[model samples]
Target: MTKRAGSAGRPTKPLLKAPVRIGSVDARAVVGELRQLHEDAEDPDVERMPADDELFGALLYVEKHAHALRRQTPEVQRAAALRRVQLWEYVREQVDVHQMHAVDDARQAGAQWIELAPVLAVNAPSAAYNKAKRLKAVELTDETPQARPLRRTPEAVLRAERRIASERAAERQAQEVAQLRHELLVPVVERLLEQRESFESDEDIDYWWEEIEAVLPHCQTPLQMVSLRRYLDAVLRALAKIEKRTARPVALSEEALLALAAARKVRQLDASR
Candidate 1:
């Protein structure tokens, strides 16, 4: 049975001497500083405490040396514990956000709620869906450590659903834009590659050719899709400069011309918006 949602109380505050805002400082720097202070208290002469470059290793060292830390003064121990608690809280909040995103992705990939039930440790599909919704609601809440958490009310859940849907729609549109741009660029790049040997000896074409070559691998993957259009424009500009002195005009395939038109229309639409 689903338990009734309770009213959210004042959010838990870390046992910090001065309330340090979470995320305002880099985690490595904060943890490293705390580790230094604690280490100094434990053994001031230890030469091998984790340096700035070895923050992760230092964190692991502290984990392994927890027992030794117990002998340190109460003040030192309390400060360490406070930072740990705050960091863990932030980590848990991010975990919930990731979990919700994962569930959304699974659903998009055609995984039924019944299939997710087992993975979510829930007995039924509805429970799994509700749990995901709750997590989404939590993500929509203020991230400040002391902010009161959003209650799992019907209204809050509805808001979460709407926000998630809007975001997913935006993501789909961006992906579509990328795919369209890729289609526009591939043919142009193929033409460039065909003419590469001819351009190799031309000192004037060398700079732009090298630039295009540097970004070539990235164009083949969606990893840099957002910048792909810019790269294509640069390549086109370079091609224009190269075309000026060549006896033959650079020509594009009929399909490539159509794609270029479509891509420009998309760009115009985006600019108008």
Candidate 2:
């Protein structure tokens, strides 16, 4: 049976924290990493914590939590618990004791907590951060910590990258062909629009009709019969029209008769001379 994880009816119930899964490595390896960080820290008396207070704060935090944090894997549950303890101590050491601007590193650790708490822990982010800080000081709430700034993402750039990668060679070819058509088709359309050239060039339709008819005398193919008969019928119709015009005399106008009479008088005058 496929077991569903979430409760069907009680949707509003928050998700619980879960353990982080370390790859190949186990819980002891992370303890070793934390130990190395703790062992290397310089004493506050010998050297003042660096002016870049956030770094010193984070380093100190890792040292303070190293013991409890050792057993914790980088996995969500353990890491969340470790961070909560560390942050709680840091905040308590602040408002309760010194209350002045002493060890004021809330923004650094708290902001980091806001960002990472969810991945580390598996519950609501605001609730987790609050719970983590409140364990030491009783005053923290869901709204107690200042909000973490939103990080920007290059979604458009990533989408473009994915689109280019996912496209097939045929799709690329189609885009190229479309772009080429736009470039080539526009000029052709403009030329036609201006009537710069005939729709069909004279060379395109120039029929070597005499050559076609010459083949008719020896034409023996079935396909040639239709062409031959069509051509001969056209020729016969043309000849019939020519003979009809030749057989009929055109009626002469009065102006033509007058011109003929004048030419006769001129011929008579030449004879007299």
Candidate 3:
């Protein structure tokens, strides 16, 4: 094309501007389409699964949690939860590890199980029911401390009530840790702890005992610090204690969950009164 002379006497043609459009191919669509063409379809993938040893370690964690929760308190239970929160926060921010991996099974493997809440437990409805009953057992109506004429004295009753309250707190803390342990460890424990026997061996008992030992130091709740050695001696009784003798899993039944919730509500009311 020939240039045209401008009014200012400079040889010029109106610069034919490139069609100012925004698309993969200068189409009449939207601005975002061009960026979409360059964006990656998927992120770089790598091995996320824990190694064999790491998997076993995860199972150990599950076992530990289950053992602890059958008898802990709310405050202690809450601390266990904080541990999980810390792991994820640090991992996402790519932070270092110090008090890492509540179990630390995979410390050498260097494999991180980046899952959030992947463990599951199979406990009877009764376990939770028992937990609720212990926690929310307080009362306030006509059963005033001094008014109720019991074989036990007013001082004894007060002392008993205080003791029971402490015991209940321990129970709650245990329950919370139990929940955490089961969720993280159930699958792996099921996989690794597959010794086909009705009764656990003395070694098995020892392992279970060790788990209790590890978390008991962290057990600050009332009654939680008490040794379970006696129960462990009565192997069958210890099995019965957890309702772990059975393989079947039952959610807290409607009646059971309600009972626990009822106890909780009553306790809440009593505390206010």
Segments of candidate 3 deviating more than 4 angstroms:
1-152, 187-273
**Residue lDDT tens for model 1, 1-273:** 875677554353331123232543366776676667656666543356566455455555665565666777787777777766666665666667789899999999999999999999999998888888777665454334754355554355676567668889999998887677567655656555455554323454465457566666656577655455555565455555656757544434555444445444554554464
Candidate 2 lDDT over 117-182, as tens digits, reads 564353666654444433323222111154221111233224433544566666888667544533
The lDDT values for all models are: 0.62, 0.39, 0.35
> Can you write out model 3's per-residue Cα lDDT over 20-41, one digit (the tens) per residue?
2111221112112211221221
Model 1: colliding residue pairs:
none
Off by over 4 Å in 1: 1-25, 41-64, 141-149, 153-155, 163-273
Q: How close is candidate 2 to the true structure, as a TM-score?
A: 0.17
- The local lDDT score (0 to 100) that residue 137 gets in candidate 2 is 30
Question: Considering lDDT, where higher is better, how would the candidates rank from best to worst?
Answer: 1, 2, 3
Error of 1 at 90 (Å): 1.3
lDDT of 1: 0.62
RMSD of each: 11.2, 31.6, 33.1
